[model samples]
Target: MGDYEIALGASTFIKQAIDLRPDVGIVCGSGLGDIVDLVEDKQVLKYTDIPGFPVCTVSGHGGCFVFGRMGGKNVCVMKGRFHPYEGYSYREVARPIRVMKLLGVKTLIVTNVAGGVDLSFKIGDIMIIEDHVDFASMVGRNPLMGPNDERFGIRFPSMTGAYDKELRAVAHQCADEMGLGDVVRDGVYFYLAGPVYETPATSRILRGLGCGTVSMSTTAEVITARHLGLRVLGLSLVVDLAPVGQADDAVGPTHEEVLSVANSRSLVVAKLIEAVLRRITV
Candidate 1:
């Protein structure tokens, strides 16, 4: 618990200074930082100033920790995230989840911008992640690859029910009430170790493995949270569609594209998150 102690101490200090003890923690992806704008009476902390917090290097990621009221609930939100592609270890990437747990956050909501592997998906669509295909573990890299911290969780934690089904059902119901029933999708997300976008063959392989969407992050965080007995909810914004080897000159997605698509779909995502917050008893 030494590492966790150092990380948690720093997070707790900041959280206390802000006078915010939230029941919920949210990690916003790529271009989804705008949700912080909806936070009332917000307190913002820069990641660089937080001890043990990894600085975000990706564009469109606003690296800040925000605490405030959303949908009548106090929430702590990470406006950006650490990635393995930025040279951080899996444990380092999972540090924020540990910090959230220490800060008394029982529920975690994670979001990401991804490429649609399912033909039915379109850009600007939102998918509720029911399950994930962790290609990172398949290739021998995992956030839980090191010594297990007994204080944190066991050495072998079951991920069979990583996502909270009840929360997902509530989210869908909220979306339907908001007249977005047709746009909410539910499926498996494929996580790859990528600073680079997928090749045609990689996309095909992921599709064959039943991946609905593909992204470079999320799996590590989910694994860490589930291990710690936290309820989890995941959402993905479809930024681009994976080309099925149709065109060599296909215009692959860029960080800019991800931000644009996420920006366009931010309202719907924000509404769903807000509704979930309103419904949860804390």
Candidate 2:
């Protein structure tokens, strides 16, 4: 729940976001910031300019906010995401969602660059997150740890439909229509605390748990968005093919590789999102 301070802080982004009257909010993770550039008539605001917004301190993240029209609907975009590995509290990591809610955002589109733990996944692939294992929430570091805020959501909300089926359908339809189906996947995302890439053993453990993709940021934001009653749509760009079982089974991932993959594939990723948004009624 947003207390006075949190809610007040939201006012800053809200003041600017209101004019746009955004119904959709997009949080771009890692190499996905390019979507902000594709936004029509976009207005860019640096994270430093937004009061109470956490800064993104990683490579490949743009650390700003972009507002614009997409598919005839006003949208707000977080050009970069916050991470606990960057020393941000869970609440801080989720603040952007609260601000979006205050601004009347109804649907959240979250994108991340993930390592593919599922053996069948490959680099440059896009995985639509059908479900997730939120380590942060399981370990009690959830952004919603404090007292519940009814204004944001109920104390115990059902996640059965947290990620809207219609939105997922829209994404699938978009991918098929664009001939991007070959690179698209649907699976579960796993969240872990990471400044370092996971070890092969860890990858095996996650794979055994049925994780298709692994990310450090999106789940917290997803939980926040759901808590605020926003419909969620998550996608992970498979930048690295993780070593799931073998000892050093896969090639070690470098930030450079992740960046290159994301940079090169962003055009397609952007297209998928754009096409989906053009069809999303909410």
Candidate 3:
């Protein structure tokens, strides 16, 4: 079966189980899955239960979909998001986004925990993704690389505005209002294909490339969301500092450390998301 068929089948199965049509879709990454707890009157469906769905193998992901209301709008929250590092193709990693599009999601909010590649960044800071350096896509691993599915989108979709401008403006305003103006920043997200963290040398290279935040996920999903014409808003939390020029034996990031930071600061991210959702026209 093709990707479009798989997405359609999943959406069909989900629609049969829930009467609500989502206006917004949220893909929670890594330890950020707790954001779904904000969903009111939620109906959850495990990935294992959904047809053509890929299960999450990572530790931080919840592996379920939560459908409910938030900010006075019906929404679908992906409690777990797939990654290329998990042995999935770029297309498979982004399939849920297509499913969300089929389920009537007009807007997509994606969040991930990333290492801070820029020297100015500190752990626990939130970076509003103004743009991204899709390293994987640059080498031809884009989610839209396969045969065209015109039913879902144009054969040649433009990505200049992949991150919605209006949504980002509102996110900034919301952060300021929440007294987090100093904590929140806007920068470029560098998408690396990784199950392993970057080495000190690679981190230096990323810094040279002007990457503000770096991670393994988000780009493929954002590309898919943009292809399907969904307005996208990306939020990245800096959980660890990239080891730029540190000594070879210097301590580096661990999955456990990333989870620890993500778990601790997730509420702040949740609050910012709630504020953004409430304030946006949606």
Q: RMSD in angstroms, all models?
A: 1.4, 1.8, 1.0
Q: Order candidates by lDDT, high to low.
A: 3, 1, 2
Please give, for residues 41-60, the per-residue lDDT of candidate 3 as tens digits: 99999999999999999999
- Candidate order by TM-score, decreasing, is 3, 1, 2
| Clashes per candidate, residues 3 or more apart or on different chains | 0, 0, 0
The whole-model lDDT of each prediction reads 0.87, 0.84, 0.90
Which digits, one per residue and each the tens of the lDDT, describe model 1 over residues 6-40?
76777767866778887899999888887787788
Alpha carbon deviation, residue 49, candidate 2 (Å): 1.3
Candidate 2 lDDT over residue span 29-76, tens digit each: 788777876789887778887776777789888988788897677899
What is candidate 2's local distance difference test score?
0.84
The TM-score of predicted model 2 comes to: 0.94
- TM-score for each predicted model, relative to the true structure: 0.96, 0.94, 0.98
Which window of 10 residues has the lowest lDDT sum in candidate 2?
1-10
After superposition of all CA atoms, the RMSD between model 2 and the true structure is: 1.8
List runs of model 1 lying over 4 Å from the truth.
247-249
Q: What is the alpha-carbon RMSD of candidate 1 to the true structure?
A: 1.4
Give the lowest summed-lDDT range of ten residues in model 3. 243-252
Positional deviation of residue 64's Cα in model 3 after best superposition, in angstroms: 0.4
Distance from true position, residue 211, model 1, in Å? 0.7
